[model samples]
Target: MNEPLCPAYSVLRLLSGKWKPAILYHLREGSLRFGDLRRSLPGVSQKMLTAQLRELEADGVVVRSVMACVPPRVDYALSSLGLALLPLLQQMDDFVQENREFFPSEEG
Candidate 1:
């Protein structure tokens, strides 16, 4: 077969997961504490969230900051590259909103 697509496939691989898009979507709002992120995604487990964050960080799309205080606060925010995806994400959101009727709802 032809050589597999490089960067495009790579990006899709990086962002393809049940939780990665959701995680990225929430981060678009700004940096958030781990607890806050977890709260935003009610069904994600702590271990899964940690793993996804680590993966995103490794992929250069997420930044993790830790404050060396008594409680040792930790927060996550998007990197420049990740921020670049916002407009695309917003467009995707708009498309979904505009075409909601075509998508099946869980309640149904």
Candidate 2:
């Protein structure tokens, strides 16, 4: 019989995508327009970014707001839930940094 997934697994699933953690990390500073976020993450495709943002918004981890303007602008920011996750993300970053020698360098 199959057992239910653990709470940690659920959290992992919510932030599983390659770009989700980075997206959250960038948003930790403050809200950013869609174009700005896209520019910040160089390798992400527009379509992928859109999809990920939508997923995050749906998951209640990110908030998307539309501003009235000549051309309507959309901005993304971390929700309370997302903010709560920052410390965990930072801990993960700290662990990885502390064990840097175990991981392969990006230059390889």
Candidate 3:
């Protein structure tokens, strides 16, 4: 019997969540203001977004910047380490596009 298809489980151990991918996907375009990110990701509660952002920040995949202003604006963007992941993410996107039909969806 084949032991298991995915023998390596540590990778999943590092990024274990539903929203991380969405957050990363959003950062692919470049910097986004905190409110913009929240608006872009519909259905994500403030609590969840805050939690995911904090986790990504801790993982060094996202940078948080605060601009001095009357209200002190905050922004998020991919860091050097985060940019390093672009190729991998883009490759994944390409692969999915190449074989998208393998996974069907209700949405057109």
Candidate 4:
């Protein structure tokens, strides 16, 4: 069946994962090793982080590079496609700050 397409849906779909947003935010700065990335996002299990990274890599949003060394270290960075999302994410951050009253914190 043919269905009407919504542009924003695609963007939303790409970022629907719980960890995707945070992952992108962290990668916005630059590349990070698996261990460092894991440390940045506390409470995230290794399995979950691996899965999320694979998804982002598959989506062409993240670039996974393996170093040719004794330990064979791997680093994850955002591709050009992922970089495009930075501005949008910043806008969302700004919106949240502007309307903080709409969102309540636990310590309210």
Q: Compared with the true structure, what per-residue lDDT tens digits does model 3 show for residues 1-108?
A: 665558545344335677777887888889999889999988899899999899889888899999999898999998887787677668877988899889676367
lDDT of 1 by residue, 1-108 (tens): 676567667667778778999999999989999999999998999999999999999999999999999999999999998998778778888998899988767676
Candidate 4 TM-score, C-alpha based: 0.91
Task: Give the winner by TM-score: 1 or 3.
Answer: 1
lDDT of 3: 0.81
Model 4 per-residue lDDT at 98: 94
Pick by TM-score: which candidate is best? 2
Candidate with best lDDT? 2
lDDT (tens digit, per residue) of candidate 2 on 1-108: 555476688789779899999999999999999999999999999999999999999999999999999799999999999999999999999999999988778777
RMSD from true fold, candidate 1: 2.4
- What lDDT tens digits, residue by residue, belong to model 4 across residues 26-108? 99999999999999999899999999999999999999999999889999999999999999999998998899999777464
Q: Pairing residues by index, what is the TM-score of model 3?
A: 0.80
Better of 2 and 4 by TM-score: 2
Error of 1 at 40 (Å): 0.8
**What's each prediction's TM-score?**
0.87, 0.93, 0.80, 0.91
CA lDDT of each candidate?
0.90, 0.94, 0.81, 0.93
Q: How many residue pairs clash in each candidate?
A: 0, 0, 0, 0
Off by over 4 Å in 4: 1-5, 106-108
Higher-ranked by lDDT: 1 or 3:
1
RMSD of 2: 1.9
Clashing pairs in 2: none
Error of 3 at 31 (Å): 1.3
- Pitting candidate 1 against candidate 4, the one with the higher lDDT is 4
